[model samples]
Target: MAHKRFAQIPMSKRMRELCKEEDFAFLKSQPDQDQSSEESKLQESQTQKKLERDHRQEERQLNEQERQREIEEQKKVQCHAEKEEKWKSHVAELAVKREAIHAKLHRLREFRDFQKKVLLQDLDPGSTNETINHLLMRL
Candidate 1:
């Protein structure tokens, strides 16, 4: 066993499980079987490494997807909050505008009422020269 030359080579788990002396004697008696065992052990080690790499890659992809989803969710929440704030501000502004319109209408009604009173007074039959002059000016 040239252990110094192959320090990194690991013992095969499958071969370790078949630790009977008879198993090794039989494999040694058959050269093809011994070579096949060596090849299979190397293949198994490579397959294991590949599986680990695939698992790590899959985990990374899943983590990235979750992070993206969280970002999108946060953006949606922020946009919803902004829209609500804008809606509230617009409602407040409309309320102020509506109050201003109502105040103008109230003033106009008061002025119209004053004009009606003045016209009624002028139309009175007991009124004299000033009422006749006012009526002639209206015509």
Candidate 2:
């Protein structure tokens, strides 16, 4: 069996060849020995920092919005509970008022019965004192 050998190109050589073929003049251009344009470096770092800061700000805003919603929901629940309590108290007050009205009606009925009895009884002026005494005793 015969073994076939393949030629392998170095990675840096291949990159250089590709750069030449593509006419990528930017990569081959040299900067002052310090490396990279100061303006471009400053813009890149500032842009990255700005993006991170903006992301954090957005997250904080979202969290605040969520907390506000929760607070609103709790307020709604509390308001509903207060309304329910007010309704129950109103109902109880109405019941008490109704009972008082019933008691007054019963007292009026008793007074009417007493007046009817007095009208039905016929007494002479001489016996008025005796009738008064009898009525007082019944009471």
Candidate 3:
């Protein structure tokens, strides 16, 4: 029954009851040591929580920066596509203008040939058809 009662007490308190006076003085300070150890553990837990919060904030900032970079890249790609389309349109317009200029130059050449034929006919009213054809061929 006495053993059962001793077992009911905590191990440290049991040691305190059995210890000499000098050893009891040392055991009496055990609670203060336990309190200081608990305080250190609490400070360590708070520091760990603060570090975790800082790490989470850094991750969020990095994610936002990556998102911004992707957006800027998309904008650059869109702008480049727009510029390429405009360049192709301008090239097509220039081709059309070139063809129109070529057609005008061909018409001008035909008109000049017709004027030369008329001038030759006026200059030689008695010329034979064969002679006029031969002169035109030489021209």
Candidate 4:
């Protein structure tokens, strides 16, 4: 019912009632508003691009750091393996030397026993076997 009465008013009077100085000023400045909006959108796009670029740079830096860490770890592993190899070789050499020394010691003991029984006459006939031995005579 109110809408019916309001519609009954003349269009010209409605236009005159709705018109205002501020409205015309706003309408006249519409082009500048559009330009400002475009500028703001361009700024936002540039800022977004910069943020994406920074994110990619950070990701690359992280990847580089990870790669460096992996390389360092590999180097450490390689160095450790090399050291282990050296230690194994050293241990093997030591084992060889020990076996050779044991063989030489066994030969020397056999020689000493032979000498005591055959070459040495009766230096101390009552003396028992021991590490230290003396011969009264030689062959």
Candidate 5:
């Protein structure tokens, strides 16, 4: 039982506690164990390197994605601002057109009133000057 417990300790620790003759004997008996331990250490180092490489690759991909997202956001904002500017300009153009149309309508109204007055005077030439003055005043 004590030997089993002793064997459970690591080989390096066991060698430290053992006499030189016993250590030599143990090493001779476990040549394959030492080789297997070296192989395991090599495997662990390779695995650690692979994990670090994968982590760096993942970080690069995340940073690239964030950069793309920022670019896309900038494009969206620029597009929105351009669209807003176009809409504002369109509204301003419409307001200008509306004002021009109102001015033309006012001119047409004045011309219509003048024509009506001329037609009335021609249709009733005998209308008194006082009556014409009263009608013009009412207009």
Candidate 6:
């Protein structure tokens, strides 16, 4: 009977003490846990902001590179156009020179034919100089 009462008193008192210790532990951890949670949230926001800034910077660099490429392409096209224009002008000049040469060749052929006719008239055995002159005038 005495052993049973001793057991009951110790068990109840131990349970009460354990409950008090748990309560104290909970109270002690609350402020520290809250502070850690706040710090974690702040760190997350900072990381998000950094990511956004990096994204914007990357986008700007891409745009700049594209613009530079466009400018270079335009310059190349313009240079090609200028070269084409120069080629066309050179071809036109060559054509003019070719026409002048063709005209000169025609005139030279006419002059050669005239000289051949004069030589043939002088070589004819029966035709006198006066007759040759008359024939030449008729021609």
Q: Which has the greatest TM-score?
A: 4
- Per-residue lDDT of model 2, residues 17-133, tens digit only: 665656546644534465668866886799999999999999999999999999999999999999999999999999999999999999988986786467447655456655665
Clashes of 4: 0
| List of clashing residue pairs for candidate 5 | none
TM-score of 5: 0.57
> Which ranges of candidate 6 are over 4 A from the true structure?
1-42, 120-139
Candidate 4 pairs with clashing backbones: none
Q: Candidate 4, residues 15-120: lDDT per residue as tens digits? A: 6545555567777756564477778788789999999999999999999999999999999999999999999999999999999999999998898777777533
| List of clashing residue pairs for candidate 1 | none
For each candidate, what TM-score against the reference? Answer: 0.53, 0.54, 0.56, 0.61, 0.57, 0.54
Candidate 5 RMSD to the real structure: 10.7
Please state the error at residue 106 of candidate 6 in Å. Answer: 1.2
Relative to the unseen true structure, what is the C-alpha lDDT of residue 53 in candidate 4, on a scale of 0 to 100?
100
Global lDDT scores for all candidate models:
0.78, 0.75, 0.80, 0.76, 0.80, 0.80
- Over 39-65, each residue of candidate 3 has an lDDT whose tens digit, in order, gives 878878999999999999999999999
Candidate 6: residue 133 lDDT (0-100) = 56
Candidate 1 — what's its lDDT? 0.78
Number of clashing pairs per prediction, in order: 0, 0, 0, 0, 0, 0
Error of 3 at 17 (Å): 46
Worst ten in a row by lDDT for model 2: 1-10
Clashing pairs in 2: none
lDDT of 4 at 46: 100
lDDT of 1 by residue, 44-126 (tens): 89999999999999999999999999999999999999999999999999999999999999998897667656766767667
CA displacement after TM-score superposition, residue 53 of candidate 2 (Å):
1.6
How would the candidate models be sorted by TM-score, starting from the highest? 4, 5, 3, 2, 6, 1
Query: Alpha carbon lDDT of residue 6, candidate 5?
Result: 61
